[model samples]
Target: MTERTAKAARRARVLDDIDLRLLRALWMDGRARVRVLARDLALADSAVSVRLRRLREQGVLAGVHAEVDPAVLGLTTQALVMIRLSPNTDSRAYEERLRTMRSVLGAVALVGDFDLEVHLACRDMADLERSVTALRDAGAESTHTQLIARTVAGLGQALLTEEEPA
Candidate 1:
């Protein structure tokens, strides 16, 4: 069999029907109570609780969190940064630097003209400028920054919102 197919088969064996059902229910409602899930799934409360605890222990389920509105925190601007790294720069080192910055919402390595892409939530244009400067100091050869006009689907909402196929 193909390498990718073998990997998929191995992953599939890791989670069974009950595990999938619990994960799906949690995905739908992160804070769902064990009793509620038990009633819905027609399982015992103890069973549901045990499974939930096991999932957490196995690292299958990460802790749930509330999605806070950035505007409420005075973060009024979202910027996308495309970074070109210097030939001698290490992408992992640059990414590590970004991880420590509070304004950086997300960062990823990429291919082509830009070596890295980062998402920033800022208070204003000045904040964005400073963020770009910091990136430059952190081994970015150059950067192109764009202010996000509107977010149609992003920042963990892609799975939450269903859209009609184009």
Candidate 2:
């Protein structure tokens, strides 16, 4: 391998305790200020800032976004739709097309009986039905829908331990 590729591989393996702590803090609260993060983690502000920059540069840290309530935003209907495509169909093209659809919030290319799993958000049941029908007409062989009751644990909590630190 080339020198640049070797250096990149080496950098990927270099996460220490402080780096983990910094990631934990940000995962808990993406909106956390650099000063507050430094104080909470007992590190210098500059150190935290530098670490955050490095994380972003390395593509380990993606963009941060605000969590919005679906009900308040008029998106009252949410469903997990599993789609089965016809044999020999290109799943990647179908996934890419579904991602561009307005009602589809997230899409995952899957294995087993279903080719794609899609998360849809809509204003009501009617809208959700329409979106599903559109997907079926577009090329899905069959589809199944399951309503999302609630998120028991969010991403941050799921990734980190629930127990409080001593």
Candidate 3:
């Protein structure tokens, strides 16, 4: 789908107060039982279950996953690497190449100066260097990288609890 169509599809999901509460509770602890969430939200267990199912169906609530610490996995360094591709290059091909790299956690296509931004988790500086080299080999014309000093907040904190004006 086109970017505008994709945005419109995502915007179509309407989240109400109960959905917000359910998301908040899940963010705090993904594995929380429906009974506990219902108790916390003062709703019936069956109602909470149905709401959760609806959220999943609407793609508002993705799968619950374990949040693993990178340090424990020997990936102690994090970096944001912005890449500018050669003119007329197929960005989808470059993104698919990035997906094959184990160090790349995620990639985002950008609208401005940078063509893409990559989030990387590496064992050390050498690993990061290798990752950059791989990107260069994959057709990145230029790159700007910055080591992440710290994360102030994460995806959980950024989730919307209420709808904003369109």
Candidate 4:
């Protein structure tokens, strides 16, 4: 779908006050018990359950997943590696190859000088070198790596709870 059409489709999923609260609650703790959520929202357990189901059905609530720290897994270093794809490279296959690499935390397609931006978390310089080499093997024509000094903002905060203009 076109970007405009996709955005309009997303905007069609109107989030009311209850929906916002429920989403915020889930964002805080995806594994929170339904009873706890109901109590927090001052709603019945069944109501909370129904709302959650509806949210999932409407594509508002994606599946719950554990966000693991790279450090916890012995990945101490992090870098944002911007890559230019080689000519005739298969974008889908290249991305699939990136997914198989444990050190590649995330990869996103871009519209600027770089074709893809990769988030790499590795054990050390040697591990980072290996990952970059692997990326080149997977079809990166060239790369520019920037070590992350610190994250000014992390993902734990509630993003959707902000007061969006109507």
Candidate 5:
């Protein structure tokens, strides 16, 4: 094997306990300032910065994004749609198509009975119906939908550990 390839492999395995601690800190709070993180992790600021830069370069740190509350923005209607596709269908193609629609917030490729699970945000029941109808017209054999009453947890909060820090 090439020496460059072997060196890259070694570098990948060099992450230690400190790196894991830094990652956990970032995961809990993406907006954490580098200085504060360095203090918390009891490492030098430059060291923390180096680790963060390396993590970003290695693609371990994808991108930091903000989390917004949909309910506060008057998006009161949230629906989970279970779509069943035709036999031997290419659901991914349809999934990509659904993503292009404004109401579709997220889509997941599923196994078993349902081919895709879609999450949608709409203004009301009528809008939800319209969105579902469009999906049906686009080749979904059938869909089962349930209105979300509340969102108890979200992606940002869900990433943290269940137990609070002492």
Candidate 6:
């Protein structure tokens, strides 16, 4: 078989039915106990533990993280920033810098008119302006920002309910 075909076959077999269900359960509550997960998945506690370890080892499951409330951090304003940089700028380096910013919740690399989409939680509009200024200094050629009125769903909400890989 060709290399491409073999790679596709390997990707298809990565996750089975039990892995999908376990992923869904963990997505909802990362802190769930092994016993609780075993009960939910109809598996033995030891089996659940083994599956979880395998998932982590395969890099399929990143570490669990707490979803913090921006309000609790005194951040009352939320904005989505669409940024475009000069063709010569390095997007990966800029993304890494964004990780060091206190207001940056997350950032995505885009392929269309925009180069990056950044989610920011700030104390107020003034804080957002500061972030915009920093973006320009960091090599953003142009930026368009919009205030987020509300969030109906979070990232990966749609993908979370899908079945296991074929």
Tens-place lDDT per residue, model 3, 20-122, is 7788889889999999999999999999999999888876777998877787899999999999998867898888888799999888999999999999999
The Cα local distance difference test for each model comes to 0.82, 0.82, 0.86, 0.87, 0.82, 0.87
Tens-digit lDDT string for candidate 1 (1-166)? 9987886656556766777777777777888998999998899999999888877775667688776778789999999999999989998888889989988988888989999889999998898888889989999899999989987743443332234334
Ranked by TM-score, the better of candidates 2 and 4 is 4
Q: What is the TM-score of each candidate against the true structure?
A: 0.75, 0.81, 0.85, 0.89, 0.76, 0.85
Ranking by TM-score: 4, 6, 3, 2, 5, 1
What is the TM-score of candidate 4?
Answer: 0.89
Among all windows of ten consecutive residues in candidate 4, which has the lowest summed lDDT? 156-165
> RMSDs, each prediction?
4.3, 4.7, 2.9, 2.4, 5.9, 3.4
Candidate 6 per-residue C-alpha lDDT over 31-106 given as tens digits, one digit per residue, 9 for 90 to 100: 9999999999999999999999998886677789898889898998999999999777898888888988999999
**Candidate 1 lDDT trough over 10 residues, lowest sum:** 156-165
Span of 10 residues, lowest total lDDT, candidate 5: 154-163
Q: What number of clashing residue pairs does each candidate have, in the order they appear? A: 0, 0, 0, 0, 0, 0
Query: After TM-score superposition, what is the CA distance of residue 160 in candidate 4 from its true location, in Å?
Result: 1.4
What is the per-residue lDDT of model 2 for residues 1-166, given as tens digits with 9 covering 90 to 100? 9988886667657766677777788877889999999999898999999999998887667677787777787988999999998665677778777867888888888878888888998999999999999888767999999999876655554333434455
Best by TM-score: 4
lDDT of 4 by residue, 87-108 (tens): 9899888998987999988989
- Higher-ranked by lDDT: 1 or 3: 3
Error of 3 at 150 (Å): 1.1
**lDDT value, candidate 2, whole model:** 0.82
